[model samples]
Target: MLALVSAPTNLGLRPPQPGSVPGASKAPEALREAGLFELLRVGGAREAGAIVPGRYVDDDATRPPGRVRNESALVAHALRLAGRVGTILDAGDAPVVVGGDCSVLVGIGVALARRGGTGLIHLDGHTDFRHPGNSGACASVAGEDLAVAVGLHWPAIADIGGLGPYFAPGRTAHLGHRDDDERATEARDLLGAVVSAREARQTASATTAARIHAVAGTGYWLQLDVDILDPDVMPAVDSPDPGGLDTGELGALLRELAPRAIGASITVFDPDLDPDGRCARALVDLLAAPLTTLGSALR
Candidate 1:
């Protein structure tokens, strides 16, 4: 059985500028409305409920500038998600989590940790290890989820579930990161067996999975960020960068990886940007393939 979970919090994104729709929060419903659940019929599935943020206060006196904005709500939100995901795992069902953003990974990490330390597979275009800024200006805490999970960021998030550094440095593999070195410098210091986009091109997905699994050992959780797909095919993200794998490449990777994952989450596809509904359908089609195989394997 598979438990379909929804996390609709966008506190990780840049705050809405007036009338703009912070579209990521709408992803859970959008995906369901697009027939994603029906298309990938498993033993069971349902929304895990949404977590919209409330209140924002600057705490520059204690926190680094901007890191404190929505800090309390986001941390509490992750714990809440951890509880929900823990229940899903305890029920002996693999979790197919849909997200509000990458920050949801913190909660997923928390849940996985209690099951006896798990490894992580992060598939994204950007390294997403953007350093927590010291410029006294607000930087996104949401974007640094990987950092937080590994104990490089705030202690509050890193220490959730009463465990620090959810995935060991040697156990995590970050693949398909095509972003520049400057953005990933801090993050690079902490990772292991990171496959760059260039290296990923030369290596097959199964080969990559084997290398990652060797380190991950027993099991791992897969984190899929939609922005990892090329903007030409997945242009609905908030920060679409240049150069990414096509859906075919992504599907191939998922097929090789998903069956082995204890749980997985798909993040950052904004329905508002996909005006014609093409991206939504495309996402469902792409996910349905491996998810079907993954569900059966889990069953």
Candidate 2:
């Protein structure tokens, strides 16, 4: 079974300044408007209902650059999201989580960690290992998804459920990252292994997926960030980087990973930029095709 978990959030972003429009918090509704949920339902996946956060609060983008923004609200909502995920898992459905930002990983990571032995397959354009408090970059937890997941960032987030780290270093795999940001500059004592975009392209996506599965065992949580797509094709992201995969490339990659996923989350697609909805259509197709494959494989 499959369930769509909605985390309509921008908390993981730097929070909104006074006049700023929203960022990825608009993703779930946008994709739904594009008929993603209805299409998935046609494949027999159920709309398990959106996991709404209790409240949302964001810091101004002007906060001291290196300060992690909205720490309190972020932690609180993550706990709430974790419960939602736990409930879905208890019902025995693999949750297809949609995100507010990468920060939603806090809840996903925590739930997986508590359940024990679950590994992570992180696919993104950037490494996302920066902990600004330690690395001196601007503080955005979305920028620190990997670090936070492994108990290297905020104590409230990383240490959720009294678990120290969500995924042990060796059990996690980071893939498709271009490594163009502060991630290149930070020291990665907490991250264990990674399969870079260049390395993945050097081989087949199947090879990379096999390596990820080898590390993760029978099940893993898959985190797919759309920014990992080439900017020419997927420009509706908060941070657009080049030298990444296209929608077809990502679909091919998912052909190997989707069937193995215990749960999955799609993040960082900003519909605000795609006024004509072209990107939204592409995202729905990308999501539906692999998910259809996943549903069949599980059956």
Per-residue lDDT tens digits for candidate 2, residues 130-230, read: 76456756467888888887777757667876886888877777877885555633423444457666777778877777777787665778899888898
Clashes of each: 0, 1
Q: lDDT value for candidate 2?
A: 0.78
What TM-score against the true fold does each predicted structure earn?
0.88, 0.91
Evaluated against the true structure, the overall lDDT of model 1 is 0.74
Local accuracy of candidate 1 as per-residue lDDT tens digits, 156-203: 667775787888878887876675634565556667767766666678
